[model samples]
Target: MQEFFAMGGYALYVWSSFGISLLGIVYLYFEARKYHKKQQRLVRYWLHRQSKKKSS
Candidate 1:
């Protein structure tokens, strides 16, 4: 396993790169969900307003 950990003396850098990529993916996922919810809310609001206007 020593050879595996060595990774040609670049284990630390390789692991750090993988960790940063994972964090970026997680951040993007939450941001995308928030954006989708906001869009849905805007659509619902517009539909409600249209219906109200039609009734008047």
Candidate 2:
């Protein structure tokens, strides 16, 4: 068990590399969702304006 975490004396490097990669992936996921929501709101607003123009 201890040996598994030790990673043959390279534990710090291995663990930190994994942590950075995980953090990057999670950050990108949330950022993408935020951007998507922003785009959706913009599109909805544009459509609403178009409909109002057509009605008038």
lDDT (CA) per prediction: 0.96, 1.00
- Weakest lDDT window of 10 consecutive positions for candidate 2: 1-10
* Residue-wise C-alpha lDDT for candidate 2, range 1-56, written one tens digit per residue: 99999999999999999999999999999999999999999999999999999999
Model 2 CA lDDT for position 24: 100
What is the RMSD of candidate 2? 0.8
Instruction: Show where candidate 2 strays beyond 4 Å.
Output: none
TM-score of 1: 0.87
lDDT of 1 by residue, 1-56 (tens): 98887789999998889899999999999999999999999999999999999999
**Top candidate by TM-score:** 2
lDDT of 2: 1.00
Task: Give the Cα-based TM-score of candidate 2 against the true structure.
Answer: 0.92
